[model samples]
Target: MNRSFPPLFLFLLLIGCARNSEPTTVATETADDDWWKESIVYQIYPRSFQDTDGDGIGDLNGIIERLDYIESLGVTAVWLNPIYSSPNDDNGYDISDYRNIMTDFGTMADFDRMLAGMHERDIKLIMDVVVNHSSDEHEWFVQSKSSRDNPYRDYYHWWPAEKGDPPYRYSLFDAEGNAWKYDSTTDAYYLHYFSQKQPDLNWSNPKLRQEVYDIMTFWAEKGVDGFRLDAFQFAAKDTTYPEFPGLTDTTFIDYYAMQDGLHDYLREMNEQIFSKYGVMSVAEGAGRNFEDAHALVDADRQELNMAYAFDGVDVPKYGGYALTTMKEVFSRWDAEFAEDGWLSIFLSNHDQARMVSRWGNDSPEFRAPSTKLLNTFLLSMRGTPYAYYGDEIGMTNIDFDEIEDYQDIAARNGYTKARAQGKDMEQFMRELNFLSRDNGRTPMQWTEGPQAGFTTGTPWLPVNDNHAQINVAAQEDDPNSILNHFRQMTRLRQDHPVLVHGSYELLLPDHEELYAYTREWEGVRMLVVMNFSDEGVTVDLPELENAEVVIDNYESLSRTGSSADLNPWQAVILSL
Candidate 1:
């Protein structure tokens, strides 16, 4: 299936024929009913969202109190990060008890109430299901590592010490990048693709796979609408431990991601749980390429509902990334899945740093416009858009000077590794400052008060200093504010079905400072042009000849017949 994609100018330049007033989805193949497809998913990093208790951590009750604020964003769903009982080694990702909520978060009753609250507001709740690994403290892991003859011993991958060494598997969060951690008690070395405290589960084992399914069904029956399978792409592994050649220089994800038997497990899980209760499933990654992505999703496979690919989000770097590069990646992905599979559109989440600081200009003067422009790009894209919580109000990164200031396990472990390997500590710190996951986990800014009104007590992480000027309460009344612009963008996307199910045609595909595109459905056509940089640029898209401004980030626009002069970080949606 070798295919090539020239730039798409269909709606903007070559609407050829099929121009009719009857509304329709661009692709011939689609689902009979698609709620998740039309959804605007707002990702909430619960630990930093709000804190009701004096424990300095966000809990279910805190989220319940803020339901109204979330509903006001016009979002259709909320994707909450893991709240399962954890050892806090890698935050809530290291699950100890899948059925119970973290004590810092609250009890099961609080979770029930939170789900009910979201449902009552007509907003769906997507729970994070971290099945790739479990905390060493998990009952199964504890029992499995207790003895070689334990009933749960097969639940995790273990190598007897007699075998000398388990093949070297890379660890993303280990202090010493070794995936095999020796256990004295069982005389075995267990595999952990992350922290030693977090052991990767044996997906090849049937009983262990059933355990994950049961846990998901437990939540689905409790009314969870969707599941974001965290790190699940790397769930399947070859128990024989085959050696990957030339792996030192290549990214481990190539060998680690989308292993052989992953699709079978997903298909079985879908038939056993998802098909039963109508749950939506989106795995963390789309694998390495189009074929891998399609195999995981493609609808006919009955595997996953959406491919939450990291290509777009992975575009930003400490040394800046190009607008053309982002456009190319996103446009290529959109074209790849234009017919069969679904994509999840997002730039920032719990795992990445602040969106404004990474993808947009977060400087005092340009923050609002840049953030709004980014939002415009997200909403106008042809995919299920995911908006990170603080992104709506333009949150910036809290670049820490020292590793001591970071709480992220990735950063702390990385710093330790840098020092141990005698690498360039200064450059490593620079990368850490710009790309630390802690930047996104900072406490949300609700008001200009003590702890930025996130909590009455001290926060789990220090609130960004910019919270005083950039907050929900400060921008609520200002229609031109970043927050309002986000709301406006959401509302516009909701009103125009074209924005959701339309064909996206890339205009000026080679532009370095701008991303201009058009979305057309039925006979309705819209041109969305955004200047992604801090430079005034006039775009000449003649498709906008008789265009009428529908909405814009700026209060006013300087436009002629077919061209418009965009101020730095300006964005506009024009109806042609």
Candidate 2:
């Protein structure tokens, strides 16, 4: 007979009408059920996903060619990194045009075909929207910088040169320079929280906001299901250009992003585009606290449906972040969003190191088990989960021996900053090898070949030398492979409603090497046990003594009475 476990937490996110300080009616197309609550998202970095044209760059056709592969993983939606026209300064984050596709990626027709292909396979397409900034080559930016009287001048944040250097501003990308870039022709400086080539748009301008709304509408009308807003926290800036207060607690210079009334802009955007289309939207919630996240994604706010808080992906620099940190992160969200809002769980992305390499043991002996352990936690969590490309095969980060082997602009800038600080070059390179975003940007390894079957021509970046041993081709036919394990885990999440809407409770919170949690929904309960270290651990749980072992990384569970001995880097899911 099946066992039942009583519910531990009874909470639900309150859904209310679209919000505005002024009087207005909300959109009518809201769904009765939140589809995102049960969906799995896969992030694809277009430049490295799959190259069909063999131009040494992945294109829309390439993604279309791989649609079946993506669907095979049981993912319901795809969050594509920027595919808009770009100068490639930041690998497509700097958009030159919002409405058209990059020439390298393909024509606008190709995008339509890709979208149709996905919809045909019941997959949703979520475009990457980079509204915080646009490429310097963008027509609007070009026109804005041409003359002071240009109508597009207010489209971007600009300060008169006669006023002297604008207040000390923070640049996340260019550490050594100010966030404002000086334009010679216009005799003014423009704000850019990132690279100079990418200038921040002026949200204070009503016209600029409308343009963004229109851009979003264009895509939504074209049948795109959602958007992943890139660097969205930095979208609104304090136009006043106030001096950054250098308080002891607030060490870094940040005069933008943390500004007040940012949500007002989000609400306006939702009213204008997002809500009208009834689509899912997620923001990149960097530098935001739990309270801030609640405000942005709370259903009552009529803003984004979800956002990615970087706590899980941006591991502490000094290292030694305990498994308790993960527990706190998710549990806190569970409470905060209990009445509203939603959070997204992810361990790897285009901007971070591989999951197994960063949070789990990447050694050959422990790689597969640790990879499954991380995936088990991710899929079992309450919120939507994101799987980065190449993570399924337990892909490990490459040790790009030198800086020359890297292609990410962030890595190059970091190297420059480290050298100027008098840091040891070799040590800095080693750190870069570990923490660099390029670690995730390497070409996807499809099969063992001259170029790892990624491209007939030379790849844009060097493929990992281990591709021969760990390519997808080798794992596709092996039922015990990590690829098959991911498929099974994904299918389990889809089949089990508890994994989607269950309340999470952390168990063994203080255990040094063991991370365990329980999920209870209605009267059904599930337990997930993970061993983070490369040491065997045996734990006894009376509730699970006769429980069924639904999922195990080792393909089988060793249970003796009420005690189960987990092998090194092992993980198991038991249903009671």
Candidate 3:
């Protein structure tokens, strides 16, 4: 008998267990109110998830084919990265049409089939909402650029080309020092904080805002559970277009997002669309202060349900985040949102490097254990946890040798700008190996076959060379595989109320190798201990009578009274 195929009796037994273990009651009374607060969100980058029809690109059918795999991981919500019709300038972030599906992904019928498949599995689907900008190829932008008085000209930020570059504003992208791109057709420059191909939408336009609301309503009515607003802070900008005071460096990072009118716009959005449909919405809160992060999700403000804070992903540490910084960031957010606000807790996403590579050891020996440690921390946290695609199986960053091996616009643009700045191209390439968004965009490894079983033809991006050893098929058979560990950890989160709604308290915050924290709720307390390093550590755990080891990466727990010796990259959860 094949090890991958369990005995008939064992298979029947496992099925019985699964049916019996289905969640029939909330972990806590409060959890019954909002399903999202207690649910785990799995993010899928459609272009890399799977491929069908030998198209070399992941499509809706591929996702549908793998729906059982996703459902088996116990993720209640799937947050798909942008799948709207696009020119692929920013990997679907630049939407060309609001209602149509990308031809590369599939058609509306395929999308409907995928949606129905997810609903059948009792899973919710969250669509990406990229309203901050649209592809320059979008019909709206094409009309806006036709003439100064084309009526649609107000749909995007436009200034007279005669005014000589419109007073020099900053752009987070476009290292060329000009956020405005000259269009000869209209003879004016449109503002684009990112690549010139992605024109920032003019949120001040009432008609444009109405159109966005209509787009959102269309999806909401179509049964999408929620929307993850992309680059949402940039949706509202300072219309005044004031120049910086005596600024020498014109990098446009700080001035674009979190403008004064953003909150009003969010409230208006909620009032018009989100509130009406009664759907959850999260935003990408880049460039926001702590206050703004809280304000965006404060229940009274009537904006988004949650927003992602970049302190973890944006941390300057070349390796993993410092323990102090992790404790500080999470604790601060916990304190800020303890009363009213909500936050989406995640360490990696489509635009970030794999967390196991960035924060944990990704070597052959430590990858699985370290990945478990990271997942334990994420799922056991106070806020809703988001697991990025491929991270659950301990996917590591891919190191491409040449710039042409990369497909991301940001990576290519950064390389070009860095070379122009006389930076060492080799060193820049090294940084890209670690930080490039392309690191997370590689094809998902499904098996040891050609193309890692992702496609029958060439893949959009090269599959990692280690795919043969690290693919899902091999791990699915191992009970102790990282994939199984993720499944177990995900189930633990869904079953334990303390992991979701408990008050968080940092333990041993200054410990160099140990990340220790406690979550308490309704007379229940659980301690989560993780060793972030590859070296063993001894920590004095709190004395709790009748404490039991509820979950652990390794099967064994070495405890000497109140002091416990942890193995390399070991993680444990103690019920007290």
Candidate 4:
């Protein structure tokens, strides 16, 4: 029961529930005749989910074995992270072979069987697509750098040494923060928005683009139902390599994301691959604004199925974020897409930290209730919700004290960069403890025994120490457990269309401690009231006759007509 959370970061203020007469955000029927609209996408980080072999890494056969567990959660679809062949540079993000599976994760036959097992259980499979870059060890990259005149040279961006140093660009995972890495053999600098081992693919090349489309078709033909494009917003770059004055001072995504010609590529991608197979599509990062998001997913755009914006996920950093900003960001996005297009609602994912630690109270006293409240929000939101594997059981951050415990390339390289710059090592470790992706990458906790029953061998990443108190087996039979609350919420969502196609209206948008909203569609209207604080609070609820409770995190509801009393961390759904 070691329940230590990170420094108060997100949901610092995320409080009480109340509703208004007039809607502050737009509301419309957004179901556009698509299967993905109603899907509860459960994201499984393959390396951390389960391991059948004694290799300490989760694999496709492991997923096949656990198909029943996924089905039990009532999730309609599973968004499996990359299992593609890789050198493990970025833990499978840097792909060496787009067509084969990583040796640690198993073979193509295992993947096919896993996909079939999911389909048998009525669960669709969404494969993670990492075409933004390829491993430097990939055949294409190896051949491209063999000689300057090689036919594969155009597959990647290159600036000959004869031309002066390549224009400055930023790398998200590089230790030196340099995007250009020089090759001695070709005497040229190649572009990489991530680690030096991962070279950015040239989407500008028609040949390269077609090759990507063909690889996608290969998976589609194998019966994969969806694709989550990884770091794809930066796929189409401004090859002109223009210089910026305040590059380091400004956020890098502004210059690197949603570049020119991106729409054309997406449209072409859908027409050639997505449209033909009728598979759902979503990119990892949305653009800087709403217009960019809409262009990527609007029904008329013929591009993608959902806009997986990062505004909600990126708002939490450093010390804390304003509760008002969290509400505004979600409300504004809902307003923008109320009429058309779609959004993926989520608070954490493979690349982010844990949900409750970052966005809710993770202390021992309030962990279960607060985690349930957070899942209630995610499940009842106005879009298709993506649930990371461990979030359902209230997994908090591991908060490793030293850098050696960190395995993610970002954390390791970031530490190197911080030390090189003479920054305070203690301060850097504190922030890393709170924000490192490893916080979300811990192995799934299934039991109270050694290694949380994740593997007989040591886990690829250490299992969270608090697994004894917070695990699937411990909470499986408790009706009041966070795990059960999550199950009930997902079942309610799947049983009710109002949660999917309803018009969402934010209630008491400015309240400091209350978050209240209502979802109404057709002839049904339901109110969602959540108390996101540690003290009991009161909020005036709407007056509706014959109100019956649909679902609630707490054991009982307290209230009289308009004035409803809420216990700390209580969440409720009522039908009117």
TM-score of 4: 0.95
Instruction: Give the Cα error of residue 20 in candidate 2, in Å.
Output: 32
Model 2 clashing residue pairs (backbone): 13-339, 14-339
Per-residue lDDT of model 4, residues 1-576, tens digit only: 012334322211212122223443334443334889999999999999999897789888888888888999999999999898999989999999999999999998899899889999999999999988999999999999999899899999999999998888888788888889999998999999889999999999999999999999999999999999998888998888899534441376677888898999999999998889989999976776777777899989999999888776655556666666667778777777777788999998877789998877899998899999999999998889999998999998896998889998988998998899899999889888988889999999999999998899989899988999989999999999998899999999988988888888888888877788888887788998888788899888654234788888888888777677899888999997
- Across residues 1-576, which tens digit of lDDT does each residue of candidate 2 receive? 011111100111111222212111122222554787678998899888888887888899899889999999999899999999999899999999999999989999999999999999888888999998999999999999999999999999999999888887766677474678888997899988788899998888989989999999999999999888887776777778767753211233133444676788889988887888878888875344656677788778788898677654543342345666555555555655544567798878887777788778788898889898989888887789999999998888888887788888877876787788799998777667777787788888899887788887888988889899888999999998889889999999999877877766767666777778777776778998888878888888775688888999996778887888889888899998
RMSD of 3: 8.9
In candidate 4, which residue pairs clash? 15-513, 15-514, 16-513, 16-514, 16-515
Candidate 1 per-residue lDDT, tens place, 313-357, comes to 766655667788777778877877777778899888877778888
Output the lDDT of residue 504, model 3: 75
Clashes per candidate, residues 3 or more apart or on different chains: 0, 2, 3, 5
Models, CA RMSD each = 6.0, 7.3, 8.9, 3.8
The TM-score of predicted model 2 comes to: 0.92
Q: Which regions of candidate 3 fall more than 4 Å away from where they truly are?
A: 1-33, 245-253, 319-321, 544-546
lDDT of 3 by residue, 406-482 (tens): 99887787778788889999877777778788888899999989999999989999999989888899999798888
The runs of at least 3 residues in candidate 4 whose Cα sits more than 4 Å from the true structure, single-residue gaps closed, are: 1-33, 544-546
